[model samples]
Target chain A: MNAPRVIDVRGLRYRYPDGTLALDGVDFHLCAGECVALFGANGSGKTTFALHLNGLLVGEGSVRVCGVPLAASVSAGDLALVRSKVGLVFQDSDDQLFLPTVLEDVAFGPANLGLTPEEAAARAKVALEQTGMAGALHRAPYHLSSGEKRRVALAGVLAMQPEVLVLDEPTTALDPPGQRDLIALLRTLPQAKLLVTHDTSFAAALATRAVFFERGRVAGEGGLPEIVNRFHWSR
Target chain B: MRSAARETWIVERWSRGSSPLHSLDARAKLAALAVYLLAIASTSAWTQAAVAGYAVILSAALAASRLPVPALLARAALILPFSATFALITWLSGDATRALALVEKSFLSGLAVLVVIAATPLTDLARALEAFRVPRSLVLVIQFLYRYLFVVADQAHRMRMAAACRQGIRRNARPRFHAAAGAVGVLFARSWERADGIYRAMAARGFHGTFPALAPTRFRTVDGVFLCGFALAALAVRLML
Candidate 1:
């Protein structure tokens, strides 16, 4: 039996205030426990489409996460529920880890979900331990190395217990060993993941399939090697 | 940028220490600071002895904090340029006594604030402010400003380096001034985009308005005792001396 769809989007279109059409009729979906890589150029709207999954960007499209459709007028409760279900690890860890300490930053998401302090801390501890960052719990975010910051940022999202993990350029600042460790870590996670990246090798290491985006649309979709070859995505 | 990072690290390290002052509740420390400031501000310029008493009290608190006295004093002296300007104005108005008092009070106030901040982590201090009914929005602004100050400074440093490399050792003031103006504009735009990115991240994590604390602060009997004792001591110096 096939897994249920965790994320479903169709005909998504978005335009910036300056009249730039970033996402034009994009279609995408992710099945439960499947890892999919989004291959595209810099301005191909992968990030913008990823943003739509969590209701961060409301565009002209239908986005449903874990069976809940994103309403045209997003209520606070609906937005919170969708956000808790789709955790987005942004490109820059500095932008994601805004709290003072590692533990606090990780627990921020859970606490926002209305958990008690002790409960949120427990969740955060589990997430940090899973990300191999339990030792840096009390350290400040700025004091951390780039790899550690990335792990803590991942932990922050994981603490929310999202069903779908959307990582935008996760390998932006990681060294070779850091990337290897990240691949190992991400492979262990069972959540459906959507990786928006240009790193073909990194994508092949974990992603089972891939989609190619071009000019705000889905240009192609197939096996990782097939999509990479078709788009010349490798650097 | 490196100096700013070093200074911030030093203060953060001091806050994490196991000194008695560091162990005290941030609320108690903030209350004591408020009392001390009020004492200093209410003192008459002619009451030079009271001003000295305030200094002595602040010195005792600084000693209790277990931080480096000389370093903190030097840091507090950074306020002198601004205070000295006002002091000069007062002196020119034929109020030398008031002028001296102004400088002394400002220095003492700055030192007292530094002592408290050096002993308490900013997170705990922000929690203390929330507990005291400070507006959540204002507290969040202060916390975000402090957290991102280094990031912004580092960006500015990188921009300067890039501009220097492109300029190739050009030392002309006119060109340098134009480059600086352009850099400022770019920095502002980058900061604005960064702030937007931060908001999106926050929204993705379910942040509504107020930041929830991982560990809620508890006001203990010891904290109460420290607040009362410090406030009484400050009041005594202000009134009796």
Candidate 2:
């Protein structure tokens, strides 16, 4: 018997409003409890691909998040379910943490999941504790350091208790210590993860599998070394 | 940009103070404000003795709250120019008493609101409104707008700095004006994109068009008493004067 796939995609394609093809035909899969690094150059459809997982973009293809199919016209009933199953942390933490206080922002996801305020705050508390951000609960996002903001952003999604976590450029604005802290944090999460990033070293440290994207398609995917060498991704 | 952020930060800090007024339930504070405004609007005497009642009420509230008196007055004064404009029109038309009443009422109303706002955090205020049966949609808009206002201001500041860096200090005035115009258009585009991103982030977290409180509000006996006492006092002043 094989481990069931947490995410399965086939022939995924997407185009922007101006008719620019952001993603071409692509196939991807992630098994239960695996961390996969998605590496690609700028504007190579990495973020676009992540957006599709939560039904944010709804491109041409079949995509299943925890076995829930995301259709061309995603129904409202399914959207909430799909989104609940997949927690997406965007590249910009500012985009994710928009509420006035860190605690409010962290509780946002759980509150949306229909948890009462106390329950949501409790969940946020646990998530913040896990991220080592319990002390900064009342601080605003703008007042936080870049690394702290990133952790808070992750805690916001984690509070929702999703089975699959998708992070786009999780280490964009972090220093060395911050990246190290993030890797340590990611190591402890049990959910399957899809990390979209350009940092090869960061990916090499934690990813179980690595995939390289080029020109809106997956150029190669294998062990981190194999994909990195094949694509000559190192600068 | 720094000043804009600092101003908001200062108010938020003030809102967190442990004053008797701050400790009262937001609903009570709002009710008191309503009664106070009603009294001010209904008063026809326009005499210093009549309006002195309002000054006394406000002075007591301000003293009990332990907030900065000068700062509150400064913020309240922001309403003066607009009210003064209307007052000027009335004065020109020879209704000096009505004009004076307008100016006095406006100033008092502004001061009353500033006191309540200073004592209550914006999040609490929104929650109180929700409990008071204000539409959830309107409250949610207020919540997001308050949260994003600083982000938008920061973005605009960065864009301005970027444009300035390229234009340089040696550039002529005309070219700088054109650069600023172009920068404003770019800011609009970025703001629109940022809004879309924020909406997507909200959706990705199981948002279903309604925001629930993290903790429910409780209206206590003290809050009720404060509401009744304040309202009665305002009525007394209105009727006697």
Candidate 3:
């Protein structure tokens, strides 16, 4: 039997305030425990599509996360529920790791979910241990190396206990070893992941399938190698 | 600019150290600070003994914190420039003693704040402020400003370096000034975009309005004793000295 769909987007369309059509008639879905790669050039609406999953950017189209439909006039409570279900790690780790220390940053999401301080800290500790950042819990985020910052950002999202993870350009500022470490780390996570990236090799390593985006629409969807070859995504 | 960031990091490191002053509850320390400031502010300009008393108290607290004394004193001097402007006005108005007192009180107040901040992490201090019923909006603004100041500083530093590389080494002040003005505009725009991105990230993680603390602080017996002792000492100095 096929797995359940964690995210279902049908004809998702979005336009910027300046009249730029970011996402146009895009249809997508992710099954449980599946990792999908979104491949496209810059400004191809990859990040825009990811933003919609958590209701950050409301646009025309239907977005149902974990079978909960995001209505046109979604209430704050509904958005909060959807946000808790979908964790997004932005392209810049600095943008995500705004809290003073690693532990507080990780605990932020859990605490927002109405968890008590002790409960949130416990969840944060587990997430830090999972991300191999337990030792740096008290250290300031700015003092960490680029790799450590990335892990802590991922830990922050993990603490939310989301069913879907949308990571935009996760391997931006890492060396070869950093990229390899991220691939290994991402492989162990159980949530359904959608990675928007330009690195075909990194995508090939973790993505079970790939979708190609062109000018705010899904141009093609297939296996990794096929998508890479069709779009000349490989350097 | 890099030096400023480094200095902030050093202070943050100091806050994390284990010491008697650091162990006190943040709310207690904040109360003590309030008492100390009130004593200093109410002191008469002619009462040099009271000003000296405030300085000694702050120095004792700083020593207890085990932080570098010279470095913190130097940082406290940063307020002199602003205070000096008002002090100069008072001096010109034929109140030299009052002007001296203005500088002295400002410096002592700055040192007292630095002592408290050096002993307690800013996150804990902010939590204490919230516990004291400070408006959530104001507290959030302070938290965000402190958190992002370094990021914005680093961006500005990088922009300066890049502009320097493109402009080359020249003694032309006019062109350099114009370039700097343009860079400021770019920096503002970039910062605005970054702020938007940060808000989006926060919303995605379910941050509605308030920031929640990771660990709730408990006010122990030691904290109560510290608050009472400090407040009594400050009040006695203000009334008697």
Candidate 4:
């Protein structure tokens, strides 16, 4: 049985305001229940491409998230719908966890989705439980360790219950044990994931397929071993 | 990094305390603060007594809050240097009473504000302002500023550390100032870029031009009583003094 595609992008291209072409006619997709690791160097357009998933950057592209073709004139309501369906955990947890408390930050997405305060709280609680951050719900984000902050950031996204999870640099500052814990946590989650990272071992652990970005295009794609070997990604 | 972390910690610590003052609704606390500030600002015949009364009220509130008294006073005293400048000028101009009163009122006012802040979280304070019909744009700016103050501070701290590591016992003081000025410009630019990225992340997660209220506020009868009681106390100080 062929699994349905969760994200389908054809002929995607993006350019920065300074006339730098970031993504040059790239194509990408994520199948349901499959985790795909996007391997790329800095300025390779992985992040720029991920930003387009939820209408954050409306670049020139044919992108569809859960069958929603992003419109150029996406309204706030429209973008919100897209965002709720596609949870993108940014590389910097500081950017994601902006609210005063962990629970409030987790509740942010659902609250934006027009959930009542009680419903948002409920969702936040469940997400915190899922990410093992239930105890840190009342704590300030800055007071948290890097690992805790990353988990809380994930909980914030998970609270929205998005079908697609796109995490950028999931293990940047995490210690070995923290990465193990995160990997274990990610294994339990059922959402299709798009992981943008240069961490080969991390990508190999969970990613069913891997894609490499080079010079604004997909340079290679296949099984993790094939992609890593083809791109010479690891030192 | 340590100082920035410590500064944020102090506020976080005070705000977490579950005192009666903390139990008061944010709007009620704000209303009480407004009344107290107004009473202090009024130039009345009994200005001296009002100032004394304000001090008494703030001290009582501080005691109820159960915050560290010395810490609270020190934080309040931070306002003194600026106020002292004006007070010193007033003293030189020959009105010793005015100078004394200026210092007295400013100290009391600072203490009063610190008391309210200790009792309420910054987010709650922003919510209170929103409830009071302040401009939504202004409240949004306040919320963003309060949230990102630490992020920017952390970034600045990291940059400072990098500069220190590169300094290696510098001797050129003039070049040091130039480097410091250059760093300031870079800091602001980086802050702007970070702000832009944060806004995009927010938009991606469906930030629809408003910060979602994590908990809705309901003004209870007790909140009403708290408001009335505090307002009346300030009013009594202004009038019966």
Best by DockQ: 1
lDDT tens readout by residue for model 2, B52-162: 888888888898799999988987898998999999999999999889889988999999988989999887898788888898889888887788777888888888777
What TM-score does each model's chain B reach against the true chain B? 0.88, 0.87, 0.87, 0.89
Per-residue lDDT for B59-144 in model 3, tens only?
77887899888988898898998999999999999999989988988999999999899999888998899889898788878978
Candidate 3 residue-wise lDDT, A77-153, digit = tens: 88889999999999999899998888889999999999988899899999999989999988888889999999999
The Cα error of candidate 3 at residue B113, in Å, is 2.1
Instruction: Using lDDT, rank the candidates from best to worst.
Output: 1, 3, 2, 4
Task: Put down candidate 4 lDDT per residue, A1-235, tens digits, no spaces.
Answer: 1889988998898889999999999898898899999998998999999988878887777888888788687666666777998999999888888887888889888888888988999999999999999998788887899999999989989999999999999999999999999999999999999999989999899997999999899999899999898878898
For model 3, the stretches where C-alpha displacement exceeds 4 angstroms are A75-78, B1-4, B45-48, B80-103, B169-177, B209-216
- Cα error, residue A24 of model 4, in Å, equals 2.1
Local distance difference test, per candidate? 0.90, 0.87, 0.90, 0.86
lDDT of 2: 0.87
Off by over 4 Å in 4: A71-80, B1-5, B46-51, B168-174, B213-216
lDDT tens digits by residue: candidate 2, A172-227: 98999999999999999999998898888988888869988898999998998888
- Per-candidate TM-score against the hidden true structure: 0.91, 0.89, 0.91, 0.92
Q: Report model 3's TM-score to 2 decimal places.
A: 0.91
Chain B TM-score, model 2, reads: 0.87
Error of 1 at A24 (Å): 2.8
Stretches of candidate 2 off by over 4 Å are A1-3, A73-79, A138-142, B1-4, B80-104, B168-177, B213-216
Model 1's lDDT to the true fold? 0.90
Give the winner by DockQ: 1 or 3: 1
